[model samples]
Target: MSVLSDLKTVAVHRDFRKLFAVRLVSQCGDGMFQAGLATLFFFNPQNLATAAAVAGAFAILLLPFTLVAPFAGPLLDRWRRRQVLLGGNAIRVVLTLVLAVIMVTQGVSVAVYVLALVTLGVNRFLLAALSAGLPRVVPREQLLMANTLTPTLGAVSAVAGAGLGFLIGAISPAGVLKDGLTLTVAAVLFGCASALALRLGKDQLGPDRAATGRGRSWAEVAQDLRATAVDMADGARYLVRRRTPGMGLGVMAIHRFLYGVNFIALILISRNLLNDPADAGAGLATFGLLAGLSFAGNGLAIVLTPLAHERVRPSQWIVVCLLIGAVSQGLLAITPAFAMIVASAVLLGLSVQGAKIAVDTIVQRDTHDAFRGRAFSLYDMLYNAAFAGAAALAAAVLPDEGWSALVFAVLALVYVLLAVGYRAGIARIDDTPREVPVPQPLDEPTDLV
Candidate 1:
């Protein structure tokens, strides 16, 4: 089906509509917050920076939450996911408010960094909860459409939010105050997300009582922690047993890693190479343009993914995405022109979003709810870790100008190798269709609070 048709069909599902609203609002807030941070760190005239510093910023923003993933998964499975969505967004609002204050008063410092870390950590948890909750609202057959729409639209919402934030920045008095003001706007949007989440009942999205444990004594707490560690490991084992989701995750991880490398490279090139370094506004404008173009590509993927999936299996689609990545990398390596880089951004966005939709469906379909939270937490971890690792790697190799032919060549080689390895290793499985049971909701709804 076309994107519009799929959306029209799903839009009538009441529960899904609410869940989609939460996703849309929350991601839009995320986009605004992220743009605020970008402006504060890289785009600010005063913050003339080094590659390592840039990498460190990425690390500070993403890695801490990744470290928490192993434990977070079990809680996601243990706690009511709706509660996580509600409470997480609430905390995020508070954090965003605090972050805004710090940006205004503390400027760039450890305090602001600390607050940002916690905020992002909570944001990651909220996202995992949403992914885990998805099967609760939609049928298994529509998993592809569900994944395609929720995340794709959520991404577009985020881009729109970023654009809105930028617009605010443009009109406001140009100074530290503007960045803080933009983040304050993000806080308000997060508050709206909290409100939207409240529309869902406590048990509406769940690891049902049978799947979750109740409170226990101190000794039980220790035992529970031990069990959580074991369960986290079991989650890994579970994925290994389900070769399809495992392979899908592997593809997702590789794509994210490459995406991260390109991300940092894009920042460097835009800030220092493509635009005049001394003209901070020009640099910011160039990077913003690339970001907007990439977002446009992401929007395009919403239509492209389902169509491609009709003709090819998801795993095969992944290979096609990796091939596109290789070609994009090759273009960047040779010319390094602004036009080529912009095209590369678009290609990367399309390929990444397309692969992600396929992978989300595979994982959601293959993994049961009992372990789905953990499965997605691992998914989040791999995605973020690859991204952080890429930034670290780029820091080591990329020049201030961010124009590195060697890095581009290496990235292209990795994509090609991953594509070949996937074809040999996983895609070698028989292409026979498997029966998919239509997933039911976790529980009948209780009264909305």
Candidate 2:
């Protein structure tokens, strides 16, 4: 059966379908905005300057999440999960709509852009809550499928959204009236998607609050903070204490750090550095193509990994892929040529996606439902921090010539070492390679909380 068929079989019986639908909508809007924003900045009078500023702004937004995400688990534990998810989306929807409006109004300012980026970071934190909520909606056996599918479909949506963005931006007249209509329509879609995600039912969200009397003092809030600190420490300890989880997280973090560079480097390559002014549009077009293709390669792994991992040790696969990534990053470092770089990007795509899948599957298999949310979210926060830092550094430090690509290569090489040292006993599943089990209809609700 196709990967879609597999995911559908899981979705049909559980709350996963509901959550997945919400993810799809949210991802679509985000993808559109990312593509549209980059293209818009490219055309703006202060193109390079604003573009670089936006990258730094996004990095700032991400830093707060890294510092604050550990606190969210307790909030999520105490509050209604569904409401938390919905409210987060609501904030994000407004932020995104504002962005669309600012562009159409020709009133774009770096301040407003930075504010929107921060708002999206908050929204993304709530997304972490939503991720935690998933295992509660499905059976243990299907968690991997559900987790993989969410990101896979999200990557696919990004590709489609980028296309939609490019076609609309490229093909449509920039007259205020026409641009207004499109922005208005996209805003409406963003709103609807937020509402859909907000519809997380009360039954699923109903975690019992601790009784108010004794624990309600001002000191208790401090105590609560302390308790969260302890939990976070334990969670960190849990991840690092184990050979597999620690190794897996390290490799994945490196993947994200380089991937962030890949994103920014593409823009610099296609839009700024190319020599053939006549081919500027083509170069940028290929940038989008290569980027979307990398993500497409990511989505493809939802199917391919079942076969690929069966053929080789997951650790060996990760190191080999990282080595390949280092080569491509090195190639990109030296060349100003567009086509050669785009070809190199394709190889980078394959390497990054494979490493990501290997790391995630290994960790998830070792984790239990109770701590997975906090554990995974913590890992995610670390990875996002690395990614955000890399993005900012790419913006601030990239040489007029060979900066980001070389940095990317060095980062990939570090992961190559981590992957090589990964304890094989930890990352491997001992079963004979066989057809993946089709999830029985999601007949039962899992208490991920």
Candidate 3:
């Protein structure tokens, strides 16, 4: 069904509406909070002029929490999801306020970084809770529609929040005050989200006692952690046995690595090359415009991907995306003109989003239901780590101004190689019969939480 039809069908459910509100409001806050951070870290005249500095900032904020994410799943499964949503947003409200204060008083510092990490870490759990609790509120028949609508609308809300932050920044004088005010707005929204969470019953979003059993002892929790490690290893082995999905995952990592380098370059280019470094407001405005264009490219991909799929297999579609990425980077390699850069941003956005959609389809289609969760967990790890690794590589090679023809050329070549290699690898894999498990009843709600 069309997205609009799905929304109309699912909006009849009151609980779904409540949970949806929580998602929209909280994600909106997340967007504003991230916008504030971006200004402070990348666009500010006094902070992060060099690629290395930018790389350091990303590593400090992203890596530690990423490593800890898998462990959060087990805890999320144990906690009452309603409480998780309420408490998570409530905690974020407090942390964001404190972070705003630190940003205003001390500017960017180790303390600011640490607090940001904690705040973002809390956000991770909240997001997971939202996903896990989804099954509880929506009927099994409508789960797919609910899933589709929630994430898409949540993303739109986030973009709106970022736009609001930009508007606030544009009105306020550029500096710590602008960032602090943006964060303050984010904190208020977070509090609003927390209040909305109160509308759900304490156990409405549940790990139903029957499904989860009694609370685990410390030893049991440790054992579960150990078992999770083993399960992850098994999932890796399963992917290795299933060559198509494995290649898809590898291709995604390569794409993300290259895309991450491009992202870092764009930030530096927008901050220093496109605008005067001394004029922080101008740099922020330029970056914001480019970012909106990139998001516009993402919207275009939403339209283009299905059309491409009608003509080609998911695997072939990935090649098309990689080639598009190659051409975009190739343009940048030839020239760093503002117009070319703008076009490149739109194209790369299309390329990245298109590839990701194809990869997600391949993974889900090929992976067994039992291993799908682990497969996605692995995907998430690679997704974040690849970008972090790319930042480190960019720091080594990219200049302070972020204009490097050689880097762009290398990126273009890598994209081409990845496309060729991925296509060939998948082409050679023989079709093998796999076990097809019996389908479960849709009427029964899954105990995913």
Task: Note the Cα lDDT for every prediction shown.
Answer: 0.83, 0.62, 0.78
**Winning model by lDDT:** 1
Greater lDDT among 2 and 3 belongs to: 3
Candidate 3 lDDT by residue in tens digits, 82-122: 87788889999899999889878887788898999899878
Clashes of each: 0, 0, 0
Stretches of candidate 2 off by over 4 Å are 40-43, 49-58, 101-106, 175-186, 198-200, 203-227, 275-284, 311-317, 330-339, 392-397, 401-412, 423-449
- Ordered by TM-score, highest first, the candidates read 1, 3, 2
Local accuracy of candidate 2 as per-residue lDDT tens digits, 324-360:
6777666766655666676567677767776766666
Per-candidate TM equals: 0.93, 0.79, 0.82
Per-model RMSD to reference: 3.2, 6.2, 4.5
lDDT (Cα, 0-100) at 403 in candidate 1 = 81
lDDT by residue (345-390, candidate 1, tens digit) is: 8988888888888889888888877778888999988977988998
- Give candidate 1 regions above 4 Å deviation: 174-176, 209-220, 431-449
lDDT of 3 at 338: 93
Worst 10 residues of 3 by lDDT: 438-447
Model 3 lDDT on a 0 to 1 scale: 0.78
